[model samples]
Target: MNILVISGGPRKHGRTAIAARFIERTYGFHTVDLSIVDMPMYTGEEDQSSNPFVKSLRQSVLDADAVLLLSPEYHSAMSGALKNTLDFLSSTQFLYKSVGLIAMAGGGKGGINCLNNMRTVMRGVYANAIPRQLVLDPSVFDYDRDGLNREAAEQVDGLVEELKMYARIAKEVKEQQLI
Candidate 1:
């Protein structure tokens, strides 16, 4: 399956990027690091049809069978950059798509709030976001080795598998026009 992973951290090499890269390395999924891209705030007042970045972002979501959104917890929620990115999309890009969420915290807590916020946004965009989400903290990482601990790694695997399973079901139902 073609899985698109979006690293919603504002820093290119932040914890969210680390987790996205880990998943890419482990499962061979493609990743889009939003920090490197120029994502203008979505005002929805101007015509964005010619904006290449916006088009690419929408196309990426449209092409993926599943998506994973990784964000760093910011003040008990997801970063502004991530929220802005989501604003560029709507049900046209996400409806019926299976999505997975991962929230990272610099400290050893507060990732759950970020996950919950993202889930609510996914629902608004009509994404079939799976319930098996991840809340990661500093303790789960091993920056020296550029990887997560064994337990955390296993949890990531399960989350990815869950996304794939849900994506497959969604695909089948869509193909059969079962809604």
Candidate 2:
């Protein structure tokens, strides 16, 4: 499946980015680091007709069978970059697509809030968020070597499995509708 892994942290080499890289290496999923993307703050009045970055970002979502959103909790919520990227998308872009959320916090205390917030936002865009989510603590991830500990690796495995299953179901339903 064409899964898009979005690294939502602004730091190019943060824990979130590391985790996203793990996913990319393991599953060969396409990874987009928001730090490198030239996405401007959504003002709701910008001309997207000529914006190559926006167009490319939108097309990435359109091409993906599922999306894995990785974020670092910032003040009990997702990073502003993640939220802004979502703001650029609409229901049509996300409808029926599977969304898996992974959130990281320093003490493992704030990721739940970020996951919950992301769930709500995904719902608003008509995406199906898998029930399984990964709440990561940096200590559990070997950021120095860019790997996950045993426990974190298991959780990621489950999340990826769930996302693929849901994506398959969504694709089947879409195909059925075309018949």
Candidate 3:
């Protein structure tokens, strides 16, 4: 499947990017790091011709069978940069796509809020967010900076599996409609 993973943290080497890298390595999914993507703040007046980066990002979302969104919790929610990037996408861009969410937080409690907030936003975009989610504490990666903790890794595996399953179903349904 053509899966797209978006890392929403400003720090390229932060936990959010690390999780996205793991997903890319394990699944061979394409990843877009917001830190590296030259996206200006979405101002609701953007045209495809005016902003190449936003246009390409929108096309990536439209082309993906499934998407994995990794965000670092900031102030009990997703970072402003991620939210702004998402603002550039309309509901049609994400219609019926399967989405997996991973929320990393400085404190474990904030991750849950971030996940819930992401779910609501995904719904607005008409994306089917898998019920399985990963809520992580940054401290969990302290011991193994190169990898996730065992339990966190297992949860990420489950989330990926769920996204694959849902993406398959969505594709089948779309095919049937086309037929």
Candidate 4:
């Protein structure tokens, strides 16, 4: 399955990216990182007239079978950049897609609020968001080269099993309707 991971931290070496990369590896699956680490900020209308950057970002979201958003808690929620990007991505880009969310914050609460807000947005557009969530506390892990964290790595395997199960059930239910 194709999975797109969006990391919402400005820092390239932060916990959110680390966890996302860990999940990315579990899939042996095709993936893209949508954080500031890669894509430029959204300018949906103007940039769309010429920019390959926005075009490619929109395509990636459309192609993925599942979306994984790894976000940090900013004043108890997701950062503006992440929110703005999604605001622009509503409709055909994100509609009816499966989504998985993970949030990590160093203090106060984890980014659960961020994920929930995102879930509401995704649901508004008819995306099938995965209900299981991962909330990371203290939000940082040691990455031994190659950006892989041991604990996060282990959890990804478990998450994949859930994704696979859901995919199977969804497929069966869909096929039954065709009969």
Residue 5, model 1, lDDT: 94
Model 3: what TM-score? Answer: 0.93
Error of 4 at 146 (Å): 6.1
**Between candidates 2 and 4, the lDDT winner:** 2
Question: Which ten residues in a row are the worst by lDDT in model 1?
Answer: 41-50
Per-residue lDDT of model 1, residues 1-179, tens digit only: 99999999998878888888898899999888888888888888668756899999899999999999999999889989999999999999999899999999866566998999999999999999898999888889989877899999999999998999999999999889953
Candidate 2 C-alpha lDDT tens digits along 1-179: 89999899999878888898888988899998998888888887769635787788788998999999999988888999999999989887899899999998876475999999899999999999999998888778886679888888888999999999999999999999999
Per lDDT, what order, best first? 1, 2, 3, 4
Return whichever of 1 and 3 wins on TM-score: 1
Q: Which stretches of candidate 2 lie over 4 Å from their true place?
A: none
Assess candidate 2 and give its lDDT. Answer: 0.89
The true-versus-predicted C-alpha distance at residue 53 of model 4, in Å, is 1.9
Off by over 4 Å in 1: none
**RMSD value for candidate 3:** 1.6
Model 2 TM-score (2 dp): 0.95
Q: All candidates' TM-scores?
A: 0.95, 0.95, 0.93, 0.79
| Tens-place lDDT digits, model 3, residues 69-96 | 8899888788888898888887878998
Winner on TM-score between 2 and 4 is: 2
